[model samples]
Target: MTTASPRWFKSSYSGTTSNCVEVAINLVASHGTVPVRDSKVSDGPSFSVSASAFSSFVAGVKGGRLGV
Candidate 1:
């Protein structure tokens, strides 16, 4: 098991808002998970989804399948 910490970052398309979603894709290779959290609540609850699931979610968002 890797002891690496998450390196979180928000999308560049999020503009200057502090309320955007943040993701840590760094864990995908080591843990098979993509951690996600709200930028506005840095110390709040966060969740992790499978790497494949996160990739699908991103594809849906980019393809406008989720209706933006």
Candidate 2:
């Protein structure tokens, strides 16, 4: 088994806002989930969503269906 960990990153589109979220997709292939966390809170709690669900959410955002 592979020993993997989240590799978090924030979008460049986030600009300089302190209110941002980071996501780690590195584990998705093995874990089947995407981990997300607040950029301001590195040690804070993070949550995971199914890869399919995360993909849908991204699509919605890209299509402007999520109001950005």
Best by lDDT: 2
Candidate 2 per-residue C-alpha lDDT over 2-51 given as tens digits, one digit per residue, 9 for 90 to 100: 78989999999999996999999998999999999999999999999999
> Highest TM-score, which number?
1
Worst 10 residues of 1 by lDDT: 59-68
Q: Write candidate 1's Cα lDDT for 14-53 as tens digits.
A: 8998979999999999999999999999998889999999
Pairs clashing within candidate 1: none
User: Which regions of candidate 1 fall more than 4 Å away from where they truly are?
Assistant: none
For model 2, the run of ten residues with the poorest summed lDDT: 59-68
* Model 2 TM-score, 2 decimals: 0.91
* Model 1 residue 35 CA deviation in Å: 0.3
Q: How far is candidate 2 from the true structure (C-alpha RMSD, Å)?
A: 1.2
Cα lDDT, model 1, residue 55 = 92
